[model samples]
Target: MPCPACQAPSPCPQPHVGTAWKPSPDVTVERLSPGLPRRLPLRQILCLLPLALVVVVAVQHRSVLADGFGHLATAEWPWLLAAAAATCLTWVAAAVTRQGALVERLPRRRLLATQFAAGAANHLLPTGLGASAVNLRFMAVCGVPLARSSAALALYMLAESVARVGLLVALLIAFPDALRIGVLLPDGAAGPLLLAAGAVVCVALTVLLLVRRVRTVVFSFLRTALSEARSVHARPARALALWGGAITFPALQAAGLAAVGQALGLPVPPLHMAVAYLAATVAVALVPTPGGIGSVEAALIVALVAAGGPAAVATAVVLAYRIITVWLPLLPGALTLGALVRWKVI
Candidate 1:
């Protein structure tokens, strides 16, 4: 008699009509294993979380966003274009500075992308925190030791600070009355401020010394930093990139502000505008605001007003400048950040 399951053949050995045939254990395991639930990567979740927050913020500030766009529409196109160009150059300058800080050469495209992503990150976190975290992670992924990478970060910051101070000094020399530092600082505040800063530094050093582990780590970091600094200085191009990029970064930033002032008809001289930017930024460097958000805007308005700009126009210029430098690039920058996270570049 022919089998019901296999009609062309005789009765089959395995049951196929009322019962199912089972495979061997190995095959069964192999087939079923793939069906087990797999967890999502933590990194992907982290990357998406920030994006969600950004979206929410964008929605909440839609009106402000619209206003910014409106201002851009009415802005003097030539000067605004120049400001945008300067804004673009700031990212390149940052990438160059990062390259100069590290002894090993990083991939060019990834490095620049990192800087762009860092800019977005900077806005999300407190002043400098986002960029520092991104760069630290990037260096770690690129095979740099944590201590050395941190030291490199320190070196980069120091270079930038020195350059900024030098530029501020030069500007003051050229235009002594451009900005009145006294107006920014209240009477009898300078001494207290200096003392407070000194106290903070002393406390920090004391903590480092008191904690044996921290002291050892700090010593090691200092040693690595010195070595890395020497290595960086050995190459002329790298040295120039480090210092020149540092100098150019702030100059470009100031230029962007000046250009925006011109675009909005702020009535302040270009040099005065630059001085105001430098002074405002330096004044609020320790404010701990995200990208110096509220503090920067307030300081900038005050500085510009002090520099002889009318209050209303100064406010407009500051708003427009923030729009150009911060808000415009934010979405694209956020996207770049996510892409870098997905690719494990940061």
Candidate 2:
């Protein structure tokens, strides 16, 4: 509308024009494709290539994959029960770790659900993104502030790593000759190297925790979250116990593999499976893929075979392990994730 002072048939204001209509800010739109060709669609297609490759492999190896179905039949009821017990222990240990890391109280049931859901998502999602996302969402839903939730996640992850490293070290030390046999490690001194690496990681983590400034920066964001977990009792004793559980989690998985080996009647010892299993697991974690998918399966098969298990047997064991540890939980996780969404918990 024209100003009254200079009005000569001024434009009429329509419906609270001046009162409610502040000038809209100018939004400049630049041509992002000025020089570069639009390649995102191509990139998206390429991104899916790996998944396609996995499907092809699965199809090609359908017979071998089908043979893996026999694993369920081979499952000795007694050992299966033991594996189940170990799995339960895994959750118990995780709850303890969460409690320790929170330095506050967390419901055991919730933590365990989070654990299972995270694992399940990790498996179902194309990349491990689904699982980590689930974990963050779960923590948020549990009333942990985002910052403290992050700290809790970091601590929990570290604890899990420590456990894995510990188990690896134990196996390496207990069976030095086996390490000397593996193709993955440097000749004659891998044991010391693995041990050294584990020690270094531990020391670095400890140092990070000890540095006040670093701690402040790393954990400041978690204050709101930790405060929410005020009921969580932070006891050093409990922390250690939780760490113990983290260690056992991997150990239980290893034991499961051993049980599979026995069920398959493979000649390789359980300790050998443990070492190979740990190595493959660590390797898979380093891969960029979600849940390590193709990489994990390949690594496990290679490691198990290199450790003297038959190729088909290794594949079978890995497949069975994934089925039990991954697929079994995925169905429930999807259901829970839906529930979480419906309830706006996420």
Q: What lDDT does each candidate get? A: 0.88, 0.66
Give the best candidate by TM-score.
1
Instruction: Summarize candidate 2's per-residue lDDT along 60-103 as a digit string, tens digits.
Output: 55764565566767766675566556655665666666666675
Per-residue accuracy of model 1 over 313-332 as CA lDDT, tens digit each: 88888888989998888889
Compared with the true structure, the alpha-carbon lDDT of candidate 2 equals 0.66
Cα shift from native, residue 95, model 1 (Å):
0.7
Poorest lDDT segment (10 consecutive residues) of candidate 1: 21-30
> Which candidate gets the maximum lDDT versus the true structure?
1
42, model 2: CA deviation in Å? 29
Displacement of the residue 203 alpha carbon in candidate 2, Å: 22
Report lDDT (Cα) of residue 320, candidate 1: 89
- TM-score, candidate 1, is 0.86
TM-scores vs. true structure, each candidate: 0.86, 0.66
Sum up the clashes in candidate 1.
Answer: 0
Give the runs in model 2 whose Cα sits over 4 Å from its true position. Answer: 1-65, 74-77, 126-128, 180-182, 185-234
